[model samples]
Target: MAVRVLSIDAAGIDLAGVALSRLEASLRKQAGDPDACVADFFDLAAGSGAGGVPSALLFTRGHDGRPLLSIAKALRQLA
Candidate 1:
């Protein structure tokens, strides 16, 4: 299985916890695997309480440990 890293901003809401949870569930559902971990990073400029922007990095492992798509780049497409 490949590792998928999804980075999301924590400033939009209290997404650090829930975002990763949702991502993990979604990935597991889609790939039928339960191998996923989340790494949260804080960006000093964008954070409210802190000096950085809180970001979440979700790592998901698929059957080949590779991502079928890059969710982060895909999000840019929405823009």
Candidate 2:
């Protein structure tokens, strides 16, 4: 299987969040799944500095195996 990876490099800028949100939206449209989790597409994810915030939000799993927020959701709060 092909391994998909994602890397977030946020410098604490609103543009970063906006970009992430847009990316997730595009992925959803391409996959024909509006409710898709962006993280589900990636086998590996990494980030640094402020980027870590979104990386965690996208990849981190909760008790029920869900993240705290989606990329679009985090955009509103993070950006």
Candidate 3:
């Protein structure tokens, strides 16, 4: 079995429409209050649970003959 996870943070981008506002809100929330940001996006090939290593992942796509990419990650909490 395998599990895939994603964590988003201050890095990446700000784009048009809902994406921009959504990302902005997320950044603000993560900033305003927290010891660590647990909020993230994930896609699991197996079961879901709170066990995994935090790291970064990059996604790429093509738009109107142009290529676009973005960075995302699962940030580790440090005390």
Candidate 4:
């Protein structure tokens, strides 16, 4: 498995109290893991935001020798 990395920007979404909820939903829908947990899979890192918007860096390594980067890239493409 290879490591995967992704950066998300939540600047103008104005989701109010649903930011984390929305992110979890997106991760579940896109990653095909209904039980997706940020702490379980991703390593949170500092991310640069565009226009000073909030941003986050998510990184993870694939399990069982799979490439996490490819998985993340594929999911993004599908999304």
Candidate 5:
């Protein structure tokens, strides 16, 4: 048996109408509260020893009350 995983370079792709809509929908869902603060997530601490690490981290929330990206919805938008 064999397995394969598909991945996309999020930065390499351009987002437009449908994609933007999808992203907004995902952001809302992840935040739970629509008013939750949202910001671009990144992993600055990641070691430079490796390549291909995602340039950005998945949307996440802060303890102060924020929402992260709804990964599932983001993937769906790509599809």
Candidate 6:
């Protein structure tokens, strides 16, 4: 089995959206999923300082233990 992971910097919640935007685009292109989520691709998420905001958002799980927030929704929350 393989595990994929992603790391976000401590760029603050405002700019975190920027990184998530770029991540959304890349995930969309690579995964071909209309609703791409960080939890789909990353088994583990880490952050530094204020990056914890997005790290928390990205880690939110549904009943099935999958990520609940779409990149758009996460973006909205960040906004």
Top candidate (lDDT):
6
Quote each prediction's TM-score: 0.35, 0.78, 0.22, 0.33, 0.26, 0.79
The clash number for model 2 is 0
The sequence of per-residue lDDT tens digits that candidate 1 reaches over residues 1-79 is: 5443334454544444455456656766766655433221211112334212233112223597543333343234323
Write down the lDDT that model 2 would get: 0.77
Backbone clashes in model 5, listed as residue pairs: 59-69
Better of 1 and 3 by lDDT: 1
Per-candidate local distance difference test: 0.38, 0.77, 0.30, 0.42, 0.37, 0.79
lDDT by residue (1-79, candidate 5, tens digit) is: 4432223333433333234346546766786755422233222212122212221223345485443434444335445
lDDT of model 3 at position 48: 19
- The alpha-carbon lDDT assigned to residue 39 of candidate 1 equals 29
TM-score of candidate 2 relative to the true fold:
0.78
**Per-prediction count of colliding residue pairs?**
12, 0, 0, 4, 1, 0
Q: Candidate 3's residue-wise lDDT over 1-79, tens digit each?
A: 5554543333332222134335535754767842212222234212112222222212222464221222222211210
Better of 5 and 6 by lDDT: 6
Q: Which stretches of candidate 1 lie over 4 Å from their true place?
A: 1-5, 38-79
Q: How far is 40's C-alpha from truth in model 6 (Å)?
A: 0.4
TM-score result, candidate 6: 0.79
Question: lDDT (0-100) at residue 21 of candidate 3?
Answer: 38
Q: 67 in model 4: Cα distance from truth in Å? A: 21
